[model samples]
Target chain A: MILARGLRKSFGDFEAVKGIDVDVRRGESFGFLGPNGAGKSSTMRMVAAVSPISGGELHILGMDPADDGPSIRARIGVCPQEDTLDTELTVRDNLYVYGRYFGLPRKEVRARVDELLEFVQLTEKADAMVEDLSGGMKRRLTIARSLINRPDVLLLDEPTTGLDPQARHVVWDRLFRLKQQGVTIVLTTHYMDEAEQLCDRLVVMDKGLIVAEGSPLTLIREHSTREVAELRFGVAPDGDSHEALAEKIADLGHRVEVLPDRLLVYSDDGEEVIARVHERGLEPVAVLVRRSTLEDVFLRLTGRTLVD
Target chain B: MALDQRADDQRAGSTAPTSTIAGAARLFDYWAIAYRRTWKGSAISSFVTPLLYVLAMGVLLGGFIKGDPTRLEGATSYLAFVAPGMVAAQAMTTVFGEVTYPVMGMIKWHKAYFGMTATPLSVPAVVLAHLGFVLFRVGTTCAVFLLVMAPFGVFASVTGVVAAFFVQLLIGLAFATPIYAFSAGLKDESAFSLVFRLGMMPLFLFSGAFFPITNLDPWMAALARATPLWHGVDLTRMLTLDRLDWSMVAVHVAYLAVLALAGWFWAVRRLSRRMIS
Candidate 1:
């Protein structure tokens, strides 16, 4: 549904999206996972065809935004990173007006408005002002507004950001239904779990470049181990003492990654690695054995958390 | 989810998406919906304020100028002279008021225009729709102002009121388009205050709305005639007072039309840069 080759976006001397290749297929959820300043939103904007590509080629629904922006936009839905809901109008009117903005007939828009209000579970708040709805409700309204035309592809930038876990799940469920109905979903997110739960495939972005790309588990398996053992020493013994601990356990596991507050022992058996740590007489403040995840893959690739 | 599948079944057949007229009307549709809820609040500016301006300036102050040979031109009453100018001025106010804060808010605050563009609507369509809404307001305020002027006997010809209404629309567009461009380029709204205090206030006071521009120093009169509102006031006065100078009327029309066209292009350019970038 969407394709790009070495797409570039720049503002004066600053390049927001460096040259990158991407493709989103039909009826599947594709994700761009990254931290802030990873240029995910810029890439999404280019794919949405709202912002022109500074260089390289892009074909959204087989149309170039430079010439066929309106028509391309007509066929796609976009839930931008921020809620651009019309606070001046009621929730119903927000959907109504947005549908009409697509040149949809008033009667069709009215029917769709009612149905979308129900789809978002906002039928009760249909008459209420958009500002009065909670952030989650507003986000749902934005999603509903994007679906007014049954867009073939939906571009969502940070769809679940700033939402509570429950709210995020509701949005995810709605999006999953859309995907099942054969709508291509392309979303940008900094949440590893959101990427894992929602995306069939994703690209990890950092510093205006794509660092890694695969299914969540594939990314984890390729860049990280099956399980990780996290061990924390009491107050790190001293500021410089964690380095000594790192040396002690460096030969215990296949690999040891040190953070200021904790040490990650990457191994097939995290319990066995902890045993080896105990055999070395290193008493720790805390220890956890957890399966490797997309978060681990991201840290392996970029050495930073998804959100920070 | 079962409910959703049923809901999907209900909307199975889709109407043809494109409409020849609906595209242009899309943004106006938004403004229309918004106005439906807020129209009453605007009666103060549209009807009452214009009425009060005529009462304060044309009737009460006009009470002092009925027989003045210099100001009244020894023809119609002073009320007739100033009524249409107030209508034109009111139209300018609604236009300026909308294109300033609301335009800035659409760009920076509410992001309403951003929402519109996310659909098939382009930035140019958004700009045109906003300007179109301002024109709709100018039409409403002028129409109402003319109606209120009816009982006052300020109109020499009923058709002249119609002519003045169109001129107010022109004047409003002339101001709205460029001010929209200016407002869109702004990083903040500090310049909005300057727009009214420095630009609009001077034009309102010295634009021959109440007195003839010729009453001023020749240079000041020339400068007043250069402003869009002055041209609006001049044309409105000629139409309302039954003194249509065909050549001067043509000049006034051409001047405002040129400015409106120029402003429209500038706004389109400014908005395209902001949105498509």
Candidate 2:
């Protein structure tokens, strides 16, 4: 449903998206997973045809986004990262007015508004002003508004960013249903769990480049170990205690990662590695063992830290 | 079958949703809605301001101006001379004040124009729609002002009142379009207050609205003739006093038409570039 070759978008001296190629198949959910400033929103805007591309060839459903932006946008639904809802009108009027922009008949728009209100579970608040809605309700309404034309391709930029856990799950469930109905979905998210639960295929983005592209499990298995053991040690008991610990586990595990507050042992058998640690006469404060996940893959690719 | 209907709607046409005609219709609809919302406020202000102006200026100030009460240049009273200018001034004020702030709000503050553009509405559609709404407002306000003028003996005949209303609309459009263009280009709201204080106030005071241009200083008279508002007020005064001359009529109509055309042309280009690009 979507294709891009060597996509590049730059703002003056800085490039937000640099020479990345991506493809999204029909009836599949694709994700761009990255930390902040990873060019996800820029890539989404390019695909939505709202921002002009600096250098790239993009085709949405076989139509060029540069030449046929209006037509391509007509068939695609975009839920932007920010809530750009019209606060002047009632919640239902926001939907109706947006539909009017698509040249829908008034009667059809009214009917769609009713159905979409129910779909987003906002039927009771249809007459309420948009400003009166909570964040979750507003996000749901924006999602419903995107579906006003029953678009074939749905683009969601961080669909569940600020919602509570329950609200996030509700959104995930609704999006899962859309995927079942053959709507091609492309979403950008910083949350690894969300990418794992929703995206069948995803790419890890960092600093305007895609570092790894694969399925969630494939990325985890390829970039990370099978299991990880986290050992938290107290302040150094003697000289170079962290280095001493790292030396003890150096041969036991495939790799030893030392953090300021903790040390991680990456290996196939975390239990055996923990036994080896115990045998070394080191008494750590905390020990945790778990199967590796996309979080580990992401951390391994883009270090463990917050970006903005 | 249902999906087919959706596809057909998607492929309907290339024209923007807010086409010129549809935009005009939507703007008219929004104005009607705005009127309903602001009617009580408009009613009190519209009735009170004109009544106060008539009582304060016509009755109180009329006693000071030396003139034949029944025939000041073929009019019954000074009230008759100043009443139509007030109406025209009100219309011009309504159009300029309404169109400028709202257009600036849509572009800079509210981001309403950006929201409108996301749909199939073109920038030109928004401009025409707003202009259409301003015209409607001017028409309605001028009508109410004319009705209020009647008991005060402002209208010499039915044709005079109708011509006065037409002249008010002409003045409103002539001022509104260029102002709308200027307002659209503004990046901040501060400039609007300056426009009203420095620009509009001067035009209102010196536009022959309160007195004859012949009575003013020669420099002020020249300034009044150059202003679009002066031409509008002059034509309205001539019509109300039943002293319509062919040459004066031609000059008044031609001046307003030229101003309207020029403003509209500038607005079309400015709005198209700002809204569409």
> Which candidate leads the pack in lDDT?
1
Which runs of model 1 end up more than 4 angstroms from their true locations?
Answer: A236-240, B1-22, B73-75
lDDT of 2 by residue, B23-133 (tens): 445444344544565678877777777888888888899768765644455566788888887888888888867877788767766466665655545566667777887
Each candidate's interface RMSD, rounded to one decimal?
Answer: 3.7, 3.8
**Residue lDDT tens for model 1, A22-120:** 888767899999999999999988888789899989999788988887788887889999998889789999998888877777898999999899999
Pairs in steric clash, model 2: B17-B120
lDDT of 2 at B208: 80
Candidate 1 lDDT (Cα, 0 to 1): 0.84
Alpha carbon lDDT at A203, candidate 1: 94
Model 1 lDDT per residue over B151-231, tens place: 987778878877887888888888888888898888899988998999888988899887777789999988997899988
